[model samples]
Target: MEVPPSPTFPRALPSRSIPLAILSFLLVGVISLVILPHDFRLQEMFPSSCTNGAAASTSGQLADAATQPVVDLRVFLGVLTRPGMYERRAHLRLAYSLQPRPVRAVIDVRYVFCNLDKEEDRVLVAMEIIAHGDIVVLNCTENMDGGKTYECSPTSPTTTSARPTTDTYYRLAALADTLRDKPRDGLYHGFLNPCHQSRETQYMSGMGYIVSWDIAAWISAREELRHERGYEDSLFGWWMRKGGFKNVYGEEPRMYDYLDREMGEGVTCFRHELIADTVAVHKLKDRLKWARTLNFFNVTQGLKPSKMYDVDRLNSNMYHV
Candidate 1:
């Protein structure tokens, strides 16, 4: 069969139309510049999602809202735990509930664990999930020193707190303020291992750590981390080093372990007595540690005068689990 050649149109625009075309292009560009925003922003793109009607009711308030950049950062703090630790969860819930909510930021506390094995866990955990709806079940078996943390990375939670390893009995407001200044991407904020060194090998302690959302996303995208063994924190450090990510180590008396007076007054870089400005306290292995830590923070200061009984007599240090 004979094939017909397609008609060839002019490759260039007409000589006379060139000036008109350029004028039209410039007009369109100017119109676009006038119509479009000077800067792209979440609020400008999706005003309804960014601002609540109640929040920006007044014209002045709305104007202020329009001027201000909307931050979409949410801190997902997941506490890794066994599904059977109902009492511990309850305690944690109480501890978190007592904290003042962060301003202009969401701090969601999620209980993370592997699949439920025991019948008690299945039942109680399901109940807890129904009541709270803040539990995360990873696709792995329950075991410490396993790749559970690696498994959790895909979930892309932001930070950790109020777990068995540490007692975060500090002001959430202060934390929120601190977090505001934190780098949005490529940051690992916590007490780094080998506090004296700023090397790549240094890993944030498992006691608690904070990874920005971008870092979490980067971690989730890597498949090699799934099979990596050894300490989860160390593996995370390795991964960060592999990716050339940055670490923001919280230094000295600011971020330290809970100093057991009974364990002697010997102090190191990471472990020391509680100070006025503590970001975190690690090694809260027992109820006594938590009690002492909480007491030190004056968590019970709001307790009103009661005729029932005096809370003053109850020594928090005496309570041990």
Candidate 2:
């Protein structure tokens, strides 16, 4: 009778529909959060932790460098000959602390090189330098080994007789004290035992004295401060936990001077113009080398470069050569 009981009005809306819609909306929200470039929670909580950690690790590594000394000068020369060596390279570790609270900091060197010759020079070579920083943290560790170790008392009687029996405990203690008290601003410089020194010289016989040498110099440094006294919460400890080495600032003055002297008038004529054009190019190359080295470390150790800070741009305006 009247439209066949109008298809029984749906008794009730399906119960699952509302829940399903809510679930879909929640899933989309979660996905959006995950896909976003920045995570508010992460920025708020662990903003610079990644970078700081890396720096700390690098700081601690300084001791390792001392333990296993490398032929720095040789390495430097080798790297010079093989520019590829500079690619994905981790050369130095650094530790330091900033002012105010005197928190410790650490950083690692990845790639580093210096360009000595101006563009106008017959020779053009750019040295590349790179480094990785863990994180900034406290340091509170003793150099029990006295910063050196002897596998066993020298078997040779002469060696044993000559060896001072007096323990090095006092010396270690003194070093520890010094490291602890080092000021935040104080800079620590560490050079490769045999730093590689390569000269890429370009000579033009036609132009009587036109000669240029492409040179590079690289080194590492660290800084630490004694903020708190005890072992716990020690600035060095925090530095280690963070990773190590965050940033590096150094100049190989000798190398630069050497290049200038070597190049002489060859690089003088259009120095201003040459510098202006090459500064950016050199920086780009340096950054490229750094990024590559960092990527290598990340892949090998599942570690990443610091995130809390950035390197001050290479000052192209300030030309040395």
Scored by TM-score, the top model is 1
* Predicted candidate 2 versus true structure: per-residue lDDT over 155-210, tens digit per residue: 10000001011100001111122223221111111111122421111111100000
Tens digit per residue, CA lDDT, model 1, 257-320: 7778786757788788777677666667688787777777766666776778766675444443
TM-score of each: 0.69, 0.16
The clash numbers for all candidates, in the given order, read: 0, 74
**lDDT at 253, model 1:** 59
Q: What is the C-alpha RMSD of each candidate to the true structure, in Å?
A: 16.9, 29.4
Question: Deviation in angstroms for 307 in model 1?
Answer: 3.8
Which runs in model 2 stand beyond 4 Å of their true positions?
1-52, 56-82, 87-103, 108-110, 116-178, 183-321
In terms of lDDT, model 2 sits at 0.18
lDDT to native, each model: 0.49, 0.18
